[model samples]
Structures are given as structure tokens and as C-alpha cells.
Target: MIQKKAYRFLLFLILQSCTQAQTFNKAKLDSFFVALNKNDQSMGNIAISANGVLVYQNAIGFSQINKGAKTPATIDTKYRVGSITKMFTAVMIFQLIDEGKLSFETPLARYFPQLPNASKINIREMLDHRSGLHNFTSDSLYSTYMGSLSLKLK
Candidate 1:
């Protein structure tokens, strides 16, 4: 009887811990975002899910910070991914390499020979940002083009 009681207690504790871990505390998360916003440390929307269920989602700050009129950010707001794309591209390249479809030593020219100096660049060099390729976003006209595109989308 004592052994059975102990086992029951252990099972109860395990179930309690599991449920506690799965419980999403939205109020606490919201307060954290509020503090971040007050300190000018955070912007944009964030969604968190567990077990295929959305547990928390919130959007804070302006989509477009304008002195005259600011556009409030929403959950559906689209933001420029910027350098994040590079990380994602690197992950995909590595996955391809793992799948035997590509290799780190593969020359860029194999895929994009039209790119300047592609023959001299390897997949590893590109992933490491050592390909010496010009960043198009660094061009002075890039922001102008992006702003025009944003206006058209709006």
C-alpha cells in the first residue's frame, strides 16, 4: 500500500510539472513586452506556439515611424526581413549539402555563373560572407526603391 501511494504521488508530480510547463502565461509575456517598449528595446510582432497551438501573440510599436503620422504595427504587419534572410539561406544551403545535393566546395558559377567573379566564389565563401560580392542593399538607391515599393503596396 505504501509503495502504491508513493508511485501515485510521483505520477501526480510528473503530471503537474508537465501541465505547468505547457501553460502559457500571457500576462507575464505582455508585461515583458510593455517593459521592452517603454525602454525602446523592442518592436514588431511575435507569435509563440506549442504543440501546434498558438499560445501567445502580440504586436507593438509603429510599422512606419513618421513625425507627422505613424502607422501602428499589427499582428499581420509585414516587416523587412533584412539580414535574417542570409541566415535562412545559409541553413538551406547546409541542408542541401547534408542531402548530398551540394557541397561546400561547389563553385557559385555552377548555379549563377552570371554573377561577377562567380567562378572564384565557393558555397562556403558565400555562406561565410567572404565571397567579396557587393551587397545590393548597401546601394544608395536601395532605400528609395524600397520606400516606393512600400508605398505601392499600401
Candidate 2:
């Protein structure tokens, strides 16, 4: 799932960067997203901005997917962002590096000494996903915990 989201984000970035002009065909983009939602390929809100101004916004499908009751998704509906957090973390890391407050070569122990092999792992390794750290989401217990939390939150 993370890999799929990463690929989608990378493709979006490539497309965004390749465009020389800021202009976009809003109708075509809207149709594309509508088709994706109709085919059950996508279920989320999307917002596009240019020069810090909102350009377009749309939402499709349901916020909750359970069989019992589902909440229709809206522009204001919130969803679990998941691995998108990694991208923000990477950006922050880069910003810190630029500010000379952090370095890629710094050991993970400096921030997270409790993690296994933190002394041997570096920030760069973590950023590149080569740190040998266990993915908590891959554990069955994590899903169980999240499920319980959601139930309680409701």
C-alpha cells in the first residue's frame, strides 16, 4: 500500500513539475477523477492550489467503508493520510539539513535511542528505508490496536 501511494505521489509530482505553464484543464481533470471514483479506483478528497490560492477541490465516495454504515465523503471529510506522512517527514528532514540543524549522516540514536540498532543506523538510512527497522503497520497487533481505537473514537 505504501509503495502504491509512493508511486502515485511520484507520478503526480512528475506531471506537476513537467508542466511549463500554471494553467490546467479543470473540466478534464474533474472528469478523470470522477471516472476513477466511479470505477472504485479512488476514494478521497483532492485539492489543488496555485500561488497559495485554491484552484480546485473535489471529493468522491465514502469516508467510512464499513458495511454497516458509511459516511459520504465531502471536501471537508478527513481520511487516514497514512504514508503521506513520510513525505512530510522527509521534507522536514531536508529543511533541517539545509538549516544545518541536522545531517543525514547523524546516527538515529541521537533522536531515538530506544529503537533497535539505533547506534548503527543513520538518518540517511532511515530516509532511504534501509535502516532495518521493523514496520509497525506490518504487524497484526497494530491493525488490532487501530481497530479498537477507531471503535472507541466512534
Candidate 3:
């Protein structure tokens, strides 16, 4: 078993090293930015990266419309990204499951025992947004505390 694993590892490394990496031109990217500016695009940002390299980023318009502050789109730009990050998290979690290190039926409470119905929820269900965790980010009272992020669908 160990020998087979080592052989597979070596083959993976060889394939990785044998591949040619792709490159892009800054001038072409700058032209796109110029067009964006020409259109007076407001409050917009874009991020592009490949193989751990930051290939493109541009933030145009105002970060704060009231104060009129400009922020250039860059990889470091805090765009919230929202569910996109969640997508990546889901992919990594799926990969773990694929490798047999994780499972779909694992209870959510295993990690967050504080949940009222942790035993009923699972990571797989959470990834699918079907864990029945109630959203509590909205309320007139607890809204200040729990907001609307309920572990179980209310």
C-alpha cells in the first residue's frame, strides 16, 4: 500500500512539473480598464487570478458613495465575495468527502454543539442549504444579538 501511494505521488509530481504555465499581458488588461473608465462604471470591482498568481484586478468608482472615495479593484480589495467564498468552501469540503475523510451524514452539532438541533443537521445538508437551520439575522429584538443566522430553519 505504501509503495503504491509513493508511486502515485511521484507520478502526480511529474505531471505537475511537465505542464507549461500560462501568462497574460498587462497592456491588454490595461485596455479593458481604460474601457471601464470610459463607461463611467460606478462602484464595481473585478478580480482574476490563476495558479496562485494574481493576473488581473481593478476597482473602479467609489467605495463610499457619500464620501466619494475611490478604490481600485485589486485582489486585496474586500468585496465580501459572499457566496462565492462559500462555493470554494463547498468544493474543498466536497474534495474531502471524495477522499473519504468526511461524510454527508455527519451531524452539524459535532462541531457546534451549541446548536439546539445539532444532532439533526449534517454538513452535507448545510452545503445544500437544506439543514433546516432558521435564519435569525432579522428580528426586532434578538436581531441585535443573533441577528438572523439560525443553525436550524425556524
What TM-score fits each model? 0.64, 0.58, 0.54
lDDT of each residue in 31-105, candidate 2, tens digit only: 766766675667788887777978778898888967778787889776677789999999999999999999999
State the lDDT of candidate 1 residue by residue for 1-154, as single tens digits: 6654564475356445544785656676677667656655557898766678876778887788878687878888888787899988988998999999999999999999999999999999988889999987899998899889887766
lDDT of 3 by residue, 1-154 (tens): 6654564475355334434335555565556456545655434566556677666666665433335565444434444344688889999989989999889998888789998799999988899888777765444676444424332212
- lDDT scores of the candidates, listed in order: 0.78, 0.80, 0.62
- For every candidate in turn, the CA RMSD to the true structure comes to 10.7, 6.7, 13.3
| Model 3 worst lDDT window (10 residues) | 145-154
- Which residue ranges in model 2 land beyond 4 Å of their true spot? 1-42, 45-59, 67-70, 74-76
lDDT of 2 at 136: 82
Error of 1 at 94 (Å): 2.7
Q: What is the lDDT of residue 122 in candidate 1?
A: 97
By TM-score, who's the top model here?
1
After superposing candidate 1, which stretches have Cα over 4 Å from the reference? 1-28, 49-55, 67-70, 138-140, 152-154
TM-score, structure 1 vs. true: 0.64
| lDDT, model 1, position 60 | 81
> Which of candidates 1 and 3 is the stronger one according to TM-score?
1
Q: What is the descending TM-score order?
A: 1, 2, 3
